[model samples]
Target: MSDFQCHPKPKRLTWAEAACFMVTGPTAYRQLFGWPGNVVKPGEVVLIWGGAGGLGSMAIQLTRIAGAIPIAVASTDERAKFCLELGAEGVVDRTKFDHWGRLPDTTDEAGMNHFHKGARAFGKAIWEILGTRQLPKVVLEHSGQDTLPTSMYVCDNGGMVVICGGSTGYNGDVDLRHLWMRSKRLQGSHASNFREYREVIKLIDAGLLQPCLSACGTIEDVGLYHQLLHENLHPSGNMAVHINATESGSTELA
Candidate 1:
């Protein structure tokens, strides 16, 4: 294997901008463009789970670039607005709604009812925003158990849900009837392939895809930022960590 597999950063992009694209860029590209069967056709509507975060930010831009309509869901109004600014056609502010339910030990009747109630309410809000005239053709999901049930419920018949990671929870409970009866598909994708990475790089170089960088710090601060992310206290968008292998110095973890 070659030491330098990726291309040199484009002259137009700053180090922060290039760094922001590292993982999120290719994943977003694969979700929208590199799906195996290409379920999301041009001009289709895509429901983005977190339009202001790393993956969702890139997904919104890619969705727009692909000539699709992006409907973004964010936890706050400011984040929703940011997603709109990034090209999402519609926004769902989750803070305004109460979608709550914990996984129960046994799918007991009461527990199952509670879970279904929350999922139904969430799906209703999505449907209200989308209206009967328009339903999402594809759902860009990664929140996993937190949103999968609703994602499957609200998706149009024959629509697809393409998931990458389970940021909230991985053990998702999907309604089999909605999936099998409606012929909807649930697909999983890992990281992007080499070709997908290059395709995203070309877009970055051509100025078609913009990097969503929120913050940048020296490698010394990597631990600090990692803790913030682990604690769910990190800010929205991508964070850049400047790595310099030649420089030798150890910063004590604070």
Candidate 2:
């Protein structure tokens, strides 16, 4: 009667699952920042600071599909290995490098000097991987806090840094002079629109974009979800927190 036979009701996904795809798939990959064509080229290395997270996991896969080498930076060795298994060409250990505030001495001329020198060294390593004396052409910023400056440091002249969330506090001091001089671009990306969303689903359905779904939890345990995220307990990759509205409870996936 109402085209029921031709168009049956589509399956509905839970909020957590939907959030996973929205952040990691084509919207972030294609529409929001217009990746592949907009961001990277074949053989170029795209450094994703939070490669093991939901959005970062998606970025790594998309970048690989787009024909670029994905260099994922993880907080630990286990996560780095996991990202490599998920298609990353290389991995950087965040723990190895010292961030701005995390410098040895909290306050002193020596500490400040060490921080500056560390920043330069970090920039140099990144540039070497990019095959130029400049930073990467495309830098995906997902770590939110500690790695923000790294994004600023590793970006090449005319490069773009796509800012998503600030898991860490957002405010910080950066060298703006280099940004202006290099003509680097800092762009903020959010969830994709309906059209892009559908495209992402298609990629998943076709098995072209396989994001790592690390963990799953029920909705009633939302507090646990936040706790895991805040504490960095969740494994690097896509972690799903499932909510059974009907049962009014949640459970973590094995």
Candidate 3:
């Protein structure tokens, strides 16, 4: 196998740093700003799920750059603190809800009630976090089945939910009422196109975007990195594996 694969690296980013943001950075940018016809505008409120994770971390920073306010749903206290540092104006801990993003059987009335109950509590928490402010105008969603319902329900009328991945599961239950009655929109975004990706690269080179890499090591650490991610034990930031010794760079987040 080749020791390293070459690509056009951003001039301002060290090899390790570039590797850190390669996947998550462009994906976040596409979801929050670069998606055609789905731009997040100034003064809008955005809700970002997993706001401390690789994708959400970048999304939080991009939201700030776009002059929008970002609210984060974090899985842990440490992650919540990190989200705040990365520019999330408010953080809600997902652990508080027993089924924050889960849905039950539609065929069973009791199950449907249970799902709504959890969704209601989840929506209440978001509103309380924002106080009397208007509901979120955009939701940066990826945790599909677990959170899409809440994302649709909590967003303001004519708001949007831009989804990229489904870490939880693919199938999601969205209330058509929320879509048609409230005039809400659900937009699906995939990987960034060449032009969109480069836009974010420019932002990175200009120092407007920051890396959230929290761990890195040589090729020997590959197994460990996979273990961490596979087991969902990786920190809320990105991790990198250095293929070429010369590419070694500091992995600590600033």
Candidate 4:
């Protein structure tokens, strides 16, 4: 049978790494290069939400490869370290702030003030990491309700916020005043196409990218793994199960 999905494995990728690369790698590549109209350019800043997970890991390296500055948002020290190891210019500890969810209406002065204070602090954190007052040209977003408002707020004028999933709640708010006044773009993308996938594979083959898989387990641990993931206790990067083989790649990294 002819299979379009089959591609020659990269020289540096193991079977487990290949599995990790196939999805997140291509999706990330397209997000930075093809999907968004405001694609990432060299030397531009790119803010990536969930920067320690499967997609975020790929986004970090891909952004680095593209010559863009990548700042990752992570919740823990370990996760933040993982992003840094993957070449993120900086890592934001999301747990430090609490201003999340929908932006409060203008009528609620107290709520708005609290939100603004937290949001500005978070934005300032980005500036601190960057060592300058510039904003991100592109925001890689999979987080939805909790971070979208801030992403829109800190994105550079006429920048793009490209999203693929909502691991968090789906109700996200975009502050239209800044969005319209600054001419920002919010673009939605799905899984990558063949060309995108092929490019990722080639990059892996040439050693310009890594799979960044964090762990592997037997099929019996699927329930436990999913539980860990849902509870946000899973390791950084991709996690895979040994379907028919005894082992595949590095078993743990978090």
Candidate 5:
């Protein structure tokens, strides 16, 4: 392991909490701030794709701390509630929309119209939450193939959609017109560097960020967990498994 990989846990955090945030926090940070030509500015609207998921959850907190408004796209009402609880300015229930997936060719009138209609409605949903016509300045993307086009459609002009992983599929459709005409960017990102990791931990240490640990399991459950994740049937929020780490005598007697 490299020296940059090791981070000290803040005393106020449980092992589960620290572990839950260790990866997602920095990734989210990098998505918002570390990416080229896509740094999130104060008061910007950041639309997070997986609002209740691990990355989305952390992005919401980091966005707020950066003086930006965070809106989350969630699948369920329960998840929407969770996002709002985490200080999301708004949460859009993604289940209502059916126009996700690869885009049709530009000349395909019907397909393009239907897709545009649905995308506009999606943007309207965000406007409804914001009480304004302004769209997200930065869209945090992970569901690649299905939602990428819509993300491009709704993002504000000159804004960016920073993508980390493609959970839905790899082949996301992008209209080059959106790039040259609107001056928008679709940026790809991955894990953050050590500086980004340490910055997020500083937020945790300052009590500004909450580690949203949804579940904890043992080493034996890792396989089952990954299977559930692949099927998208796992519980929301981040999960942690203790590997060679014992919980015994770790908590103070209260």
Candidate 6:
């Protein structure tokens, strides 16, 4: 085998002069609203799960900038408050919402028995949150797991669900029958490409978009990083974590 060499370390990002928003805000805008069919119109309400996290915070601001009302779903009340500051028109308290009842109880045989019941309840809750029998035209799926079920439940007839991450897990039993019958579309999105990224940058430069960066930490502190991820003490309601490396040590960007 040939000898291998490690690459040089990149410069650390300092809190005093870092542009954390530059990365997430534009990317979120593209993922949430940049698709062909996912058009934004005035008076339209777009539901965004994980609304307080990095991508979610960006989505909220982008939605508002595009003149669409943003309905954000977050795990805590504090997150909801943060989302409002990011221009979310409405906030859903996921902690108060019944996730166990809304999602499939099992991926195996034992939980399948109650799957239909859970699916129905999930659908009803979605309808209630949307405030209409019709599905929302655009559903921005940010929390990969919790929002996946809600995506299937709430997408309006002929609407679209844009999925970005798999925080919850990939592969679940969705009621495809409903999707086909209703003509709803489920689309997956990943990190923004060059073109999309440039567009987002333009929006930021114009001051039409502002994404919140809530918490900041260092990558070297594996223990603290794991704890934050486990506890979900992340960007909720427009907050995001910024990991910064320093000569003294690593620090979290808040």
lDDT of 6 by residue, 20-53 (tens): 5655665677766678766767667677888887
CA-lDDT, candidates in order:
0.78, 0.66, 0.82, 0.87, 0.89, 0.64
lDDT of 4 by residue, 23-94 (tens): 788888888998546889999999999999889999999999989999999999999999999999999998
Better by TM-score, candidate 6 or 2: 2
Per-residue lDDT of 186 in model 2: 75
What lDDT is reached at residue 238 by model 6? Answer: 29
Span of ten consecutive residues with least summed lDDT in model 1: 245-254
Give candidate 3 regions above 4 Å deviation.
Answer: 1-8, 105-107, 250-254
lDDT of 5 by residue, 1-254 (tens): 77866887877877777788888999999999986666898889999998888899999999999899999999888888989999899999899999999999999999999999999999999999999888899999999999999999999999999999999999999988887799999999898888999999999989999888887888998999899888777676788887776662253322
Candidate with maximal TM-score:
5
Off by over 4 Å in 4: 246-254
Q: What does candidate 3's lDDT look like per residue over 103-181, in tens digits?
A: 5656778877876787778777777876864788889998898889889888888888999988888987787867999
What does the lDDT come to for candidate 1?
A: 0.78
- Against the hidden reference, what TM-scores do the models get? 0.86, 0.78, 0.88, 0.94, 0.95, 0.73
Ranking by lDDT: 5, 4, 3, 1, 2, 6
**Winning model by lDDT:** 5
Identify the superior model by TM-score, candidate 4 or candidate 5: 5
After superposition, the stretches of candidate 6 with alpha carbons farther than 4 Å from their true spots are 1-18, 99-134, 217-223, 235-254
> For model 3, where is the 10-residue window of minimal lDDT?
1-10
Higher-TM-score candidate of 3 and 5: 5
Q: Higher-lDDT candidate among 2 and 3?
A: 3
lDDT of 4 at 49: 93
